[model samples]
Target: MNNNKILDVAIVGYGPVGQTLAILLGRMGYNVAVYERWQALYPLPRAVFHDHEIRRVFRMMGLENELEKVSQPSACYQWFNADWKVLVEIDWSAESISDGPFGYLFNQPSLEAILDRQAKAIGNVQVHQGWEVLGLSQNDATCELNMRKVEGDGAGETRTVQAKYVIGADGANSIVRRECGIEWHDLGFDEDWLVVDLQPNAGVELDVPDIGQWCNPARPTTMVPGGPGYRRWEFMRLPHESVEDLQSTEKVWQLLSPWVTPETASLVRHAVYKFRSRIAEHWQQGRILLAGDAAHLMPPFMGQGMCSGIRDAWNLSWRLDLVLKGICSEELLNNYTTERKPQIQAVIEASMAMGKVVCVADPQAAAERDAKFLSGQVPPLPPFPGLEQGLVFKTAKAGVSGSLGIHGAIERNDKVERFDDAFGRGFFLLSIGEDPLQSLDEKLLGELNQLGVRSVRLSKDGAPGTCRDVSGKYHQFFEENQLQAVLVRPDFYLYGGVSTHSEIPALVQSLCDEVSLKREPCAQLSQAKVAVR
Candidate 1:
């Protein structure tokens, strides 16, 4: 460990979350050091799915082409009864506001390999594999990590690394979380399930099953397509079955007998996992913070476990960058846990609801559920919830305040690119028909500029320094929501919006107060009433 100078940020665990944070912070020109216990990439596939928001993050990282090579769009997810009757269906194939597929399935090992390569290519990123974090202590100024080279030539040797901040992306049993003394709260969900992976043989004529959940009283199971020809099956362990009993090759074959035979498909891997739902009481403690699995864990029912972790990485990186650059007060860090906790809780609740639907073992109850669906009456899927708290502005349409900022393609240099590329990074104030910079008073515009807000006027015709709204979704979105302008946070979340230009000052001031940004000379608000809805 190099202790000559205090580094900007030190990340524990070099998994996808850690690697993503490293790449992001490196791009922000921060010195990043990542320590992981694993000497090499875990060869097995774990998380195999991510949504379009994550795809946008990949685009920001300039790895969209590489990501496309190892991923394929997911089909609609359907649920069925024991007799193969449809209970419910979720259309995952719909185009997202981000102008991309809503969901994608990929090979995790391949994706991690690409992330590792890209992270290593960054000049400011240093990855230290086979290093174990034994202890951590932090003061107001810096955090010190005690680590040991647990493998190869320097085995058993100890060293210390100092950093301004440290992040724990080290999976479920995070040492950083433990050292911070954060308590883990179980969300009252625990189940044992056997997951099996398969690869069909060439020239096999059998049709592969579509992605779906089989909610049977006899044996609840799920089947989802992997990348390309790969497939996955998950079967719940009954009360009578022990972990030992399910681990037997014969029992595994008996479970898969209905789907494939040794002749048609080959077994890739099988493991019994105790799917659980747990979240930490808090995500931050002093200079040490938690992200990814260190902060929360959910059952794979909704396929948001890894996606949530990736979101955590993205959320934390931008906030850390702002704080490190002196653009915001350290108190801004408090909003991270305040914002992410509720969003993750909502995800957990949704996942648990899906779990309850799948884990039904009562014959009569399962029949009743099947009847409810077969009667041409099915519960509508819940809308995706936004952040319930944090740096959101209080206004007439508060619901959309904490929600994600929508994205669309814009014509740039005779080519189309996503809005982020054209608008540039950092806080963005985008207006539909008027120029926010020109309309905003100089006092407000100067303060906003000082806070690093980029003003862009979205127009119909392609013009230099203007987003063209190529898909027309931007104009439609504003028209539908009755919004004339929207302030987009750097993390791509809606900070606020206003229907009239007169409302800009109050909203910007509120945002500055939310982030604890101090203005040199505070401007007075207008007495005129402004409608933000």
Candidate 2:
């Protein structure tokens, strides 16, 4: 309705990814507009899992309690052979760097509903449901989105909206991506599977493995939680089976009968999906960018599809904020692709590896795979990849840059809580047994202050301006790494760390350089002050 008013960001798509970007940007007091073709939530399950890192992001959004109520922590993910013998087990229940369970299971619709409410409640965000993005174009200054209303009283109405930036959080078949002429690089992993979501009847319990994969050559299968009050089963289609036949309700029941009878559970939804791996050749072009499924898609074997998209939102949010606020150059956005694409590609490859192990249809190959695992000859699962190549200090101590920053409980104001909750979250400069700011001169401190970097000191004595590390995790991390200070990015990844307090200034300066912070403005202000003096 307000075509003349330019927005800071225009988001195309109102799914979880779009909603997340809107909420993140809006919370920073940016003018954000979201356009979605659907008038209402899908109200069904799609993505059923998220990791603790995503949980940390939700906590930053102030949704920790709401998420806890609607989601359940995952159990070990076990893989079995044709005879139901355990081949490999992954502990998804273990604690992670985010100070929570490694993984969780929840209904996508419920999570989206929560995010939708949060996004709409923000005064600066406008959510236009049923408005389809027809096309988008961007120049040096701004991007314009052409949209048409497809629902409600103003059906078929067209309007154009302008914004400083445009994000395509649209799904795999993204119109915005197409409009930008972006192409997808297929990773060659493709398979057809029947996905069935079921809600067990109240007061009835079904005996089933919590979360597992049955690598049977006869009929490879997957069973996992479908959020709080549901269950999901996926059956890989054998080479001889047709997609149409596998999608029938009768066939779905047959595949599910081994776990639950129709009388004991109700079928909520059943469909055939082609799980594939794909990545956009480029995620950004001038003022237009892609996030979530629009940027990449991986097999659901590792349960990182939605998680990766949400990571894009989190990673892009801070960068966009800095650029919008004029604190950094637009070139900072290029890091979004460099930092995220490699991580996403790694995830796709990892997921494909898992899919290959479980998608075997040949009896002889399946037997060989089982033998390798059961004989204790197979290597363990590789650890998840971290930020490797973007916006991180390259010359810092080994194993510090690009790794996840440590978090632990701390005592503040006589109350013990998570470190982030106590110290606040932002670009953090943390030190052990000393004040990191003490090493910086007035000019460097002023620049860091202008960037809103929070300086915190962790100590055992609980000094006036320092937080007490109640959990000892901080002390252990500092002692083992022989580090006195570390600079953490907003997304909780280490930009770099210093072994001594004197190195703090260089570390801080590196961040300023990486973000391309314009010191000329600050220098001009300083000169003006001196001239007055």
Which residue pairs come into collision in candidate 1? none
Query: What is candidate 2's local distance difference test score?
Result: 0.88
| Candidate 1 wrong stretches, greater than 4 Å | 376-378, 412-414, 461-466, 518-533
Highest lDDT against the true fold, candidate: 2
TM-scores, all models, native as reference: 0.94, 0.96
lDDT of 1 by residue, 1-533 (tens): 55777889999999899989999999889999999997888887788788888888888888888988898898998898998887888888889877787899888888899999988999989998999999999998999999999986788888899999999999999999999999999999999999988888987655534779999989999988767677888999988879888897778789888878887888888899988989999999988899999999998988898889899998988889878988777898888999999999999989998998899888998998888878977678687777778888878375568887788887766778777666556787777765555455666655676677766667788655566778888778787788888888877889888877777677777876787775666454331211110
Cα TM-score of candidate 2 = 0.96
Clashing pairs in 2: none
CA lDDT scores, all candidates in order: 0.84, 0.88
Q: Model 2: which ten-residue window has the lowest total lDDT? A: 524-533
Model 1 Cα shift for residue 503 (angstroms): 1.1
Q: What tens-digit string does per-residue lDDT give for candidate 2 at 294-372?
A: 9998999999999999999999999999899988889999878999999999999999999999999999999999999
